[model samples]
Target chain A: MAQASGKSAGKSFFGKFGVHIAVLIFVVIWTIPTLGILVSSLRDKDQIIASGWWNSFSSSTQTEAGRLPGPEAQVEKDGRFVIEGNIFGDGPARTISAFGVRSATPTQFQAGQAADLGDGVTLQLNPDGTFVLSSPVAIEGRGQRVYYASSAPPRFTTENYETVLFSEGIGRSFINSLTVTVPATIIPIMIAAFAAYALAWMRFPGRALIIATIIGLLVVPLQMTLIPLLQLYNGVALFFGVPSKTYLGIWLAHTGFGLPFAIYLLRSYMAGLPKELMESARIDGASDFEIFLKIVLPLSFPVLASFAIFQFLWVWNDLLVAIVFLGSGSDQLVLTGKLNALLGSRGGDWEILTTSAFVTIIVPLIVFFSLQRYFVRGLLAGSVKGG
Target chain B: MADLTLRQIKKAYGAINILHGIDLDIQSGEFVVFVGPSGCGKSTLLRTIAGLEEITSGELKIAGELVNDVPPSKRGIAMVFQSYALYPHMTVYDNMAFGMKIARENKAEIDRRVKQAADILQLTKYLDRLPKAMSGGQRQRVAIGRAIVRNPRVFLFDEPLSNLDAALRVATRIEIAKLKESMPNTTMIYVTHDQVEAMTLADRIVVLKDGRVEQVGTPMELYHHPGNLFVAQFIGSPAMNIVPATVEKTGASTTISITGGRKAEVPVATPADAAGAAISFGVRPEDLRIATGDSVLFEGRIDYIEQLGEVQLVYLDIGRPDTPLVVKLPGNSELKRDQLLKVDADPATLHIFNAKGRSFARDHAPALAA
Candidate 1:
């Protein structure tokens, strides 16, 4: 009876407007700005400039202008080179607020009327694609291309994505990010898994102190050591006559920065493995290396894979460390650093920024999804008594 | 194939000693079990014998060769761990062949020995499967098979069946017994806390307590005559009921007055020194029966009744709440709780122990208390 009441109480509490209220609040918070960004990214740049992305759903009353016919079309109805055309064509026209021949004086003339040009010449362009020009002087070469005030329906373009990927060099940056990420993720996992097994299981002097000290190092942020580490690398490179700025420098830097946390996490998991399994291996005549390679490695695969995902995503999206430690030269720049550069140079081009950002995040998504299967809960097999 | 001996074996960690001055010997081809409670160092002793642990201050020998400084692999012993510790990455065939492969033995010899061990353990059909794919019993068999292929002189099993379910434990236990029987020339040391396993499988049971050897005897010998009170209570289920008694007479058979104003003649020879002294009389639950005579050892009301499938335990409370005497009856017997009853036992089935928890032998008794 108590359980039944408790369950009902729990049900009513969750159903008593709390869940719906929370979800309603969350939906209101998340959906609005995402919808705004989507609409803004999709809308025509001209429409975006004229109004806000919020006004995109309805047909927009925009002012647009086109050129009028040249002096050749101006037959001598009144003994002048007459040019005539309507600016708006084949549809219902919105209000033509003003028009001008020069861009600086775009509002020089009002719609549905002729403007005086001070030589007894007049030009008139209607909402439709027809115009009348009476010129005493012969209109040769290019006649004034009349700009008319007109409205344009709201529109969007996929050309932003195309320009960013093909022209902005984000596509190559995406390839470079994958190249940096995959190896960075894999190298640390292999090295740390071996270290974790030794630290967790292999008994030697100062094991506990070493583990405690490594855990202590976990809080020391990578930013604090970046310059000193890079200085050390450059000093070494000077001795070997190798270039200071290379992918080798960046890869090694990321690896060194990622190793402590990886080893710590993997060691905690490996230590939690049942002691009986290790003893069993010893009894089976397995040397310490065999036990580590055979039992500990297979059992610890999930933690290894989880740490790999963490390190991969971290290294893939890391721009600060990459910029500080590695060269910004075009050949050695990673995707994140390159994407940051693109953002500064092409800030006005939303297409270039969004595509570049998305390209940089794609590899992390793929890596996280593929290796996540290894992070299971009960890979221990319950081998111990009562476990 | 080998006689095992421990010469004053002791284990200590820093100032705290665990096993103190243990000495024992086993003839060739004896199946010895180290049985004790938790923290009794039975498993530790087994590990020391297997050379997985270093003996602190003793000479360990197999057929009179000292192995104190030898590594586990060089000790010529194979161990089956309680968790079976099968290599999860390898197939059963490869797992069994791993040791010889590590030694760089020829492929043909490795194959022949691994196949032979597989045939013995009935794992031939599943040789290609991994440890995770096999059941618990199959995994245990594979662990045993890995040990068998080593062809060592002594076999060590550290609670190898403790991980299995009841049915599988029984099945695998029978298989181990048969393995010991067929390989009669090999010395085997098994460790367990289960009394039935120790009783059924051990040629000799070495009972332990707090890192000290309590008693060592055959299962029936330990059953019939335990060396001390601890072994007496530890080796049986529904443990033997102990009642405080006073020695009233000294003769060929010791006569003691138990609680409820009745006397018992336990079949322990008395000396002139044991007249009018205090001792404890022990009776197994199954040995007690409803008495019709005046000298019933315990006369009381049944405080509780527990019914098994074939037997019933009648808990007789003579006001010793901590250690109440119980009498075992057949399952179909007419017995119930809250019934006033008289329980008695045969004189030979009784055990007499003095105040220090040491058993008094049937042939000899201690001198009188001053």
Candidate 2:
């Protein structure tokens, strides 16, 4: 018996270790891209393109050609015509790593070296980008073209966030998304909670049939119904003489799409609650509504919070329903729509793209972290009695 | 005053009948306990009285009003469930106050009643604690406190102590007994499969079997005179020993011949038609003792003995190995296994049941006559 227990202990140790390893793997895989987007979004716009985000901590190097001031600025000194200037010319300071006359061999000469030009014209570039070009007689008309590699110190800033939030229309879209998603998430939860409580505990003639129908509706693809749903919405809007493309329209659309699963999940959870509790409450002089509001609702928090997270994340990240129901105008565009537009318009601007994407996900991250304690608890609620 | 009348109450689910036809009358302020084995519909009967379960066909009257169609809350009843069923998320104070709040009582009155109940159940210290924070016995008290805050006329308990541990069950059982003493005017119907709880706590015990009431009497009456074989075996531990016997004579004092060729006379009167009839002779193990004089009930060999602290249960093989007779003897007795022994019981304590398993004791209904 001891040996058997010892063997099982060994097996359990391996099993636990394996589970931890798998969890670590998943965390790393999910975190790396998010971390990259965050780092890239905070970097200076120029440095964002200069190097990968992994190299954002250190300096970035790039080679460029700059022309000295045309020979008009030359002077005679000790029988030599000399042209002296800073290669960077009062721009951002950079360390000149190497300099060359031709682009093909941009870094052929090290910094602080003078290259022999073979016509008694020697050029020198210092590490701080100061350079001098000298000739034995009068200089020529055109200035010298110097190709040099310069390294800029690493730069991090919130300028990308500022630009995206202020100028790129994302801030407005963020408010719009909140307007759509908060109601969309909340309205369905309220409606479905009532429906689920009725379907679970109240004995009505069609309760089982309604529950079955909702479960069946869970399989009907939202994609298949989106067009018909929008058509129906438009028909209703025309009848009511209301605008078709509005935040209310998108909110209702998301709620409609989210209700079937909400009802199904919440009903199953509410039904699994001990029947004795309802009976006890009934004996305590509570009506059906009172029992639901006071007892079942409180006990159903884990499931309710979990469903809120699911619906909030879903509606917040949704682009299709937002597009079809609401207009592409600035007032109705949600975060996902705004992020899509930014992706197309700012395709080459990693700073803008990363910043917008990060903004879009920040709400969901805060929501998930705040309510995530209930997420796993909700899923595991009905698996055990009185858990 | 709250008196419950259940007449021909039948509860069935589609075709499966859980309760056949139950008739019971509980007086005002009576502590009535329904004791039965598992699947005997004791809990169902309690729920029906609480109006939680609709009676399929019957008239249920609570406080002299028909409540068959009334909702549970309006029935003037409150039930404590086996699981305590205290709202898990509510504090003990809030749990007790919930019903009154739903009824929209004044806040001061609700406070007064809740605090009073909390004081009664010794729950004043735990009023702020949630049900999950309290121990099992404390949770049961909170449940009772919740019921009391409702101030229901009829209090129903569906095996309230079954969820508790053994020591806690005993302590809580005493607490419930004291609660009953203090109330004095609230009708309480408790249901349990534990006969010990039924015996110690009930003012009147209602024994049920297969959805029918077997017998209803005081504890001593049921112990001394069970109406049928089921109650006879069910009411006592180490159940009464019954040996097949043939009636040799029938009269006010009847004589029965046992299977082992011994004749014992019982004090129960039987009809003349019972002569020479096959019957069951029963003797409680506690009633049997070692015979000293010439009158011996059975001569047997001691087969085994279980030594309890104060008493020993000796199994005797009186020429019937399959049906050994168990006799309770003093624990300090010098007795050896496989030794010859003769045991006897008083003639008045002997029981005779007819072939139909009906007790023939004439004095069984004396309480009814009074």
Candidate 3:
């Protein structure tokens, strides 16, 4: 036994060391992309457009080398019009790579040099926005493209969020998502918790058949019932003079869809609670509802919180259910539906998509991390220790 | 408090019979215990009285109210469970106060009752602590206090101290005895498989076997004049020794012949037709003693010696008996293994049972009736 224990100790030490190595690898893999999105959101638009986010560690490029008009206002001296200008804007010039006159060939000339154009027009382009032009003709069409290497300013702004919230109609979707999520999460929990207590503890007829039917509902596809559910809601709404696609309709839809899993999870958890405890409560003169509210609810807070998180996140991030149950308007579009619209309309704007996507995920992330402890605690409660 | 009466209470679950018909009546303030082996339906009987389980076909009356169809909450009874089921989320004070709070009693009355219960259980200092924070013994007291706060006319305890450690079991058993004494008007029905608890705590014990009452009496009464062999064996440790015998003679005083042709007269009542019939003779281990050189009852070879710090029990291979005959000697006795020892006993301690395991004596035999 001692020899076997010695071998096991050696194996365990190496096993733990291997686990540390695996965790480090996992952390690196998970963190890099989130960091990329965060960093890409901070840099200025020009810098982001000019260089890849992976290259964000180094300085960005801005072309410099300005031109001046030729001497055309004075008396015609050597039959030339002249102008003078510098390359840089009001900002400081940091590096000069190449300059150009044509738009397609923007990086054609060097800074602080004279380039001969073959017809008495020797243009001297300085690093700053000061240059001399011999022709002195009007500059038209597109102006000279001054290309240089200038460091982009470290820019971080909430302008994208402001624009999305106020102008792009996502603010309404945010409120609409909350409208769907809170009631959807709460309604199912209240109903499911009662169902779970009855299924777990109460002696009644057809309990096994009810529980089995609920488990069967858990595996049924939401798509199969979507049309019928929508028709049911519409028929009821028409009778009540309510809108066909109101928040109540969608909340009810999500609640119905989320109920099977919620009831199954909570019933399993409540059933695992020691039967002795409930019998003790019964002997203490508590009714079924009294025991449920007083004993089962307090003991079931962890599982309740876990299921709340699950249903809340699912409803918050849901697109298919929202589309089926609601109209195509800003007033009822949830964050996920709004984001899908943004994908098609604002396809070229990475900043818009990333900012809106991040905003949509932010609520779920908060809900998950805040209630993660309850998730672990409730899962542990239903499996081993009590059962 | 008033007496509890159970008339032919039987329990069966869907074609599987758990408890056969049972009947008993307990006087007011009596600490009656139901003692039995495992799966013997003793706990079932206690639950039926508590209204946690319905009696299948019998009437159970608490304080003269037939509560067969009444709910547990409306039955006006409280129970302390085997697991000491205190609410895990509530403090000791809140746990004791929960039923009263639900009843909507005035705050002052609830507080007065809770404080009184806590004081009785000596749990005032730990009122603010949750049950999980308390030790096993402390939690059990809180469970009892919860029942005490209900202030029912009858208390049902379902193996309340079985979850305790040995030392705690003894201490809590004594506390329960003291609790019973304190509440002289509250009739308590306790159920336990531990005979020591029944022996030390009950005013009257109901020993049950196979869902029927085996015997019911005071501890000493049952010890001396058990009605059957089952009680004869169950009532004491190292159970009463039995050997086959024949009724050699019968009269107002019955005489029996041992297997080896030795005759003895027992002060018992038997029918005249019992002579020449087979019977079994029983005697307690402590009742038998070593025989002197001239004394005679039976003779045997010493087979084993077990010295239990306070007593030495000698096992003798009296050949005619189906098992080894054991005799318990006082602590200072000088008996050794393999010693051929002759054993004798006071004839009054001799217990003779008929062939059907029925004891052949009145309810209180001469051992105590003297």
Candidate 4:
């Protein structure tokens, strides 16, 4: 009973309520904007601008101006001359809440209330976009213009995604992104794993210096090296008689920029592995390379996976590096670059922008969720002991 | 089967010396244990023999072949680490078969050896489980099984039983002892700080201090004929008690006076120049008893009593409050606090050491004297 009481005491107010509240706050902070983009992407083109994504599930109130049908279509309904027609003739129905004859007071009169036109003429606009304009004398050939506040029912469609993907070049850029990100992620991880194992386990000259150098490289801003590296690449390309901006160049560029942090992360984790495991393997007749491949690599899976996720996400969302290394051609443009081009060209098109934004983040979401198990385990691996 | 030899093996990490010129000869089929206090370089010595560590200066030979520069695997040695470093990601079967797999042995032969080792360790049921799934003793057996699968000529253990709880430690100790019995031709070198393990499992024990071996002998030899005060105090449980004394008579049999003016004759011989010199008198707790007649060595008051099931430990304050001499008596012995007690020990069991804490050479052989 004392043990139970102690356990309960450990799980007091802060442990139960405060922790969940903190997690809820973080969930709200991260997912709210992503959810907004997703909801906006699926909305109809006009409704996207008509209201916020939060109001997409309900009707939205918007002021619109419409003219009644001409006198030719109007019919006499009473002893006095009466012209009757729906303001929204053949369009979708909208509920008009208020109406006015002038643009300055667009909602001057409530729907179903009569408004005098100053010379014995009256106009009544109903909630269903229908209006009755009557006069003591015969009505004119042209119908009256009325402004009204109307609410349209919620609209949702997949046409925005269709248009953006088919015509906006996002699909091709997605494939280009895959080509860049997959190779960029794999190359750095492969090289870093080998370098990490060598630095962690193998005894050699200047190994500590190499480790310190890698840690130093981690702090060097990529902006400082991007130009110099590009120039170096161009020089090599010029000597080799090849195009300067190629997919291979971007892959190598990303690999070069990502290697320091990758090696740093992987080496620290690999070094934390039990030293006796390596010594035991050595005495078991396995060489350094064999031990690295069989023992170290298999045990380092958590770290490797986490690095892969990091590199994948960074490369996928990268615009500066992709723009600097790759060409602007349709076939070579990456997703982030293509998204930037779309922002400039279709600045007013909310549907296109939201759809593109959602598409760009979807792949990273899938990657993170798929590998997040290993990511969390990797973070906690150092504190836990194995048998 | 192989005989192992170490000659002046010295290990240093940039002047922080860990081992200082360790020289040992381990015969084939012999179980040798290295026991010492922490920081005595016992584990480092084992690693050096396993070739996991390189000696700064000296030679290591296995089966008459100098393997100083050879890789661990090429030296025909297998080591069981203290942590039982079984690959966490592999199953028990794979953990045992990893070495043979790396050596590119035939599939049939690898399967046969792995299965045989598994059966010997009674791990046939746990073959498919991961290391983390098994208990501590089970994991320890797997580690030993991994070493056995290699068919090594020289087997080394680096404090293998240190990680287990008390009950499991005893069980695994027996398992390791049985493993040695089954492989009688293989030369095994074990390292542990627990002298009980060294005393029970070792055919010969090497006691180390400050990176130097103090004495090498059988367990009983070290118990009865400790080469120095350190070896005497380190070997037995409850530790041998040592008190300051002055040598008043030096001859074939030396007579020393304790702090309370009580003089006792030790059968061991002292050097002729040791007269009027201070010395340390040592005796094991179990070797002492309540004196009945006039052969009493010292009289004191009972300070405390601990009643174990079979034996009780009686702490006697021999007028020295800081250093109470312990005596092991029967559990049913009638004893009380502050009771005047006269304790005595056999002359043969008494140990005499010089002022430098070195044991005096024994010229009075009990067997020849009889």
Candidate 5:
């Protein structure tokens, strides 16, 4: 028995370590992309182009070309003709590692060393980018081309955020996304809550048919309905003399798309509430409205919050719905649309793309973290009895 | 307070009928308990009166007005649920005050009534606590307190004590009895499957089976003079013992012959046509005693003895194979198994049920009229 128990203990220890390792792997997998975006968004624009985001915390080296003074500006020093200049003109100082006169081999010579030109002529470049060339013959042509490798220390800046928010128009799109998301999340919740409560607790003719239709709608793909719905909205807008592409239009479209799932989630929760509560409320001199407001709504809060988070995230990240319903005007384009536009225009600019992506994800991350407690509670509500 | 009257009330769902026509008149200030086995429609009947479930066909009146179509809030009734059904999010104060607040009562009146109820239920110190934080009995009291603050004409309880543990059930039952005494004008209807609660707490008991009323009387009246075999077995613990017999003579005092060639006389008035009819002899376990003289009614061998501390139950096999007659005797009685014994019961305490399962009227003082 002791041997068996000892073996079992060893098995449990391994089991626990295996679980922890699995969790660590998942955490790394989930966080790597987010960390990449955050690191890339904060780096200097020049440094962003120099290396990968993971190397942002270390120095980056690059080979760059520059020019020297011509023969007229050469001065005679110690019976030799000399030309002197800085490789990097009017820019932040960088450490020069090596220098070369040929493009084929930019770092052929190390800094602080003289290299012969095969006619008693030599060139020397210092670590701080100062270069001197001495020749027996007067230099007649334009200064010989010079190349050098310089290493810059790790750099960080907030300029990318400023440029994306102001010059790239992501700030305005952020407001537009909020406008579409808040009302779209709230409107469907209001309508679906009433529908769910009635379906779960109230008695009326055709109630079962209505519930079945809602469930059937859940399986129908939103892609199938998009065109018909757009056309319908356009017809309504024309008849009413209103603009077809408006925030209100997109809000309604999102509400329509989210209602089926919202009602499905909420009705099951409302139905699971003890039947005695409603009856007791009725006997306590409460009308149907009173019972809903006083009892049903409060008890349904967890499920409501869970659905709110879901709907908010979906509408916030939605590109297709916003693009189809709203105009692509600067004032109306949502963050997802703006990001798509940026991908087309600034396709090669890593700083612009990564910073914009990070900005787009911030709101959803905040919302998920804040309401995660309610989300867990709501999912567990109907599976257990009592509290 | 107002009296409630129901005339031929019935409820059906789709094609399945739950309640056959039930007619009952509950006087004002009466504490009536509806007791039965599960699925007996007692809870359904209570809900129908509360107007939570619509009655399919009936005439229901509160005081003098027919309220078939009236909403529940306007019916002047309140209910305490088996699960307490207190608003879980609300504090005890808010739970009891919910009804008054919905009625738009003034602040002072609501506060006054809420405090009065809290004082009555001994919940003054816990008014700010939520239902989840309280014990089950405390939650039940909060439910009753919620109903009390409504000050309705009638109060309904749907198995309020069934959810409590045994010790708490007894304590809360006594609390409810005192609550009824303090508010003598409000008529209350309680429903439960427990016979002890029915026997102790009810002014009158309504025994139901298969969605129909079998008998309705005061606790003692139903105990001593059950209208049929169903009530005879339902109202007592260890239930009443019944044995098959054949009627030999029918008169003011009818005589029946048992299966073992034993004859017993029961003091019940039966018609002359009942002679030679098949019948059942009924006696309670606690009513029989060991016979010491020659007037014994039954002779059997002891099959088994169950030794309870205060009393012992002796099972006897006279002739029936499926059921053995049990007699309750003093504890520590020196009676071994398989020993022959004779038992007898007073003729006045005996019961005779005709072939139709209906009990014949007794010749003693009329307990039914009382």
Candidate 6:
């Protein structure tokens, strides 16, 4: 028995270690892209192109070209002709670590040292961008072309966010997304909650058939309804003399698409509630509506919260619904649509794309984190009794 | 307060019948408890009276007003559920006040009633706590308090104490009894599988089996004179023991011959035709005692003994191998297994059931009459 237990204990120790390793790998896999996008979006656009986002914290080295002062500006000092200038011309300074007369050996000459440029000419560049070019003969040409290796300090800025939000139209699309998502999330929940309560508690003929139909509808793919729903909306719009692609149209579309699952989820939860509660409420003289509003709604909070999170995330992150039901103009473009547009137009502009992606996910992240307790509770609502 | 009259209340789901034509008249202010085994439809009957379940065909009158088609709230009834059913998110105060608030009662009246109910249930300190934060007993009290604030004419409790632990069940049962006493004018109907609760807390107990009432009487009346075999076995702990016998003689005192050729006379009236009829001799385990007199009813080898500290159960093999005659003896009584022992009961306490499991009417034994 002791030996068996010892072996089992050893196996469990390794099992636990294996689980930790798997969790760590999962965490890394999930966090790396988000971390990369955040780091890339904050980086200088040039640095983002120069190297990966992983290297954004470290200084980047680049070989740059600058011109020395022309002979016309030469000054004779100590009986020698001299040309002087700074390598960085009135911009943010970069340290000139090394300079070379020839491009092939840019780093051969260290800073603060004079180098022979053949024919009795010498050039010295300081780390602070100050350069001195002196010649035994007066300099005759426009400034000699110089190549030097300079190291720029790491740059972090909100410029990418500003560009994405203001110029890239993500900020506008954000409001548009909220406009579509909030009403879409809320309308379905309202309709589904009432339907769920009725189906669960109220008595009516063909109730079972209605519940079965909803469950059947749950399996019907959303893609199958797109064209028919669009045509229906257009016909309605023509009849009502309103625009077809209005927020109201998309909100209704989403509500229609979301209702089946929402009702299915909520009805199951509502049905699972102790029958005595509804009976007690009824005995207390509450009307069906009153009981639904007072008892069923309050007790169904966990399932409601769970469904809200699901619907909110689905609506907020939806691209297909937005593109189909909403016009792609600046006025109606939602965040997902805007992100898709950015992906196409700024295909190589990682900075803008990353920034826009981060902006689009921020609200969902905030929502998920803030309501995670309810989300977990909602997910586990009917899986366990009284949980 | 109102009297509830249920006339031929029959509920059926297609062909499966539940509550087979239940007819019960609940007098105003009477505390009646429905006691039955599982699936006996006690809860269903209570729900029917609460107006939660529609009766398929019946006339229900509350205070002499036909309320068969009335909605539950309009029926002037409040129910405490077995699972408490307190709203999980609501504070005890709000939970108790919910009905009044829904009725749009005056705010001060709601407050007064809620506070009064809370005080009655000793829940004043926990009024602000949510149901989930309170213990099971406390939640049940909140449920009761919710019912109280409505001030309904009839109160219904559907196995309200069943959810609690043993000790808490007793405590809550007593609280319910007291609550019923305090609200004497309000008719209350309680349902429970626990006979002790029915015996202790009810003015009268209605024993149901298979969707029909087997007997309706006071606790002692049901205990001393069960109408049928089912109620006899169902009401008492460890159940009453039954021994098959042949009726040897029929009179004011019927004599039956047992399996082991022991003939005993039981004080029950039987007709002349009952002679030689197959019958069941009933005796409660608690009523049987070790016989010290010459008139030993039967002798049997002790099979086993269960020592419960206060009382010991002695199982005896009286010729029937499958059915053991269980005798309840005093705790200090010492008996050995496989030893033959004689047991007897007073003829007045003995019961004789006819072939159809109906108990014959009992007559006062000569000794008791004298």
Off by over 4 Å in 2: A1-7, A75-79, B364-370
- Among these predicted structures, which one has the highest DockQ? 2
Residue B219 accuracy (lDDT) in model 1: 93
Runs in model 5 deviating more than 4 A are A1-20, A68-90, A109-146, A376-387, B366-370
TM-score of each: 0.81, 0.96, 0.89, 0.90, 0.92, 0.94
Encode model 6's per-residue lDDT on B1-370: one tens digit a residue: 8998888888888899998988888899999999999999999999888887889998889999998888888888888888887777789998898778778999999999999988888999999998889988888889988988888899999889888999998888888888888989999999999999999988889999999989988888788888889999998888899888899989877889986788998768899999999988889999999999898987899999999999999999988888898999999997889999999898778888888999987764455433
Docking class of 4: medium
Model 4 segments more than 4 A misplaced: A1-19, A63-150, A376-387, B246-259, B269-277, B363-370
After superposition, which runs of candidate 6 have C-alpha atoms over 4 Å from their true positions? Answer: A1-11, B364-370
Give the best candidate by TM-score: 2
Evaluated at residue A235, the lDDT of candidate 4 is 100
- Candidate 4 per-residue lDDT over residues A150-234, each given as its tens digit: 9999988999888888889999999999999999999999999999999998989999999999999999899998889899889
TM-score of 2: 0.96
* Model 4 lDDT per residue over B210-258, tens place: 9999999989889889999999999897899898899989999999998
Model 1 per-residue lDDT tens digits across residues A106-161: 76887657888768878776554456777887777765666666666667876666
Q: Which parts of model 3 have CA positions greater than 4 angstroms off?
A: A1-10, A52-58, A61-86, A91-146, A238-241, B258-264, B296-298, B320-322, B363-370
lDDT scores of the candidates, listed in order: 0.80, 0.90, 0.82, 0.90, 0.91, 0.88
State iRMS for model 6.
1.4
Task: Report per-candidate TM-score of chain A alone.
Answer: 0.72, 0.93, 0.83, 0.87, 0.90, 0.94
- Displacement of residue A59 (Cα, Å) in model 2 is 0.7
- Model 6, position A282: C-alpha lDDT score: 68
- Report the poorest 10 consecutive residues by lDDT, candidate 3 chain B: B361-370
Which CAPRI category fits model 1? Answer: acceptable
Clashing residue pairs in candidate 6, if any? A285-B73
Over 4 Å off in model 1, which ranges? A1-63, A73-183, A237-242, A373-387, B88-94, B105-119, B124-134, B249-252, B292-298, B317-322, B332-340, B363-370
What's the CA error at residue B303 for candidate 5, in Å?
A: 2.7
CA RMSD (A), model 3: 4.1
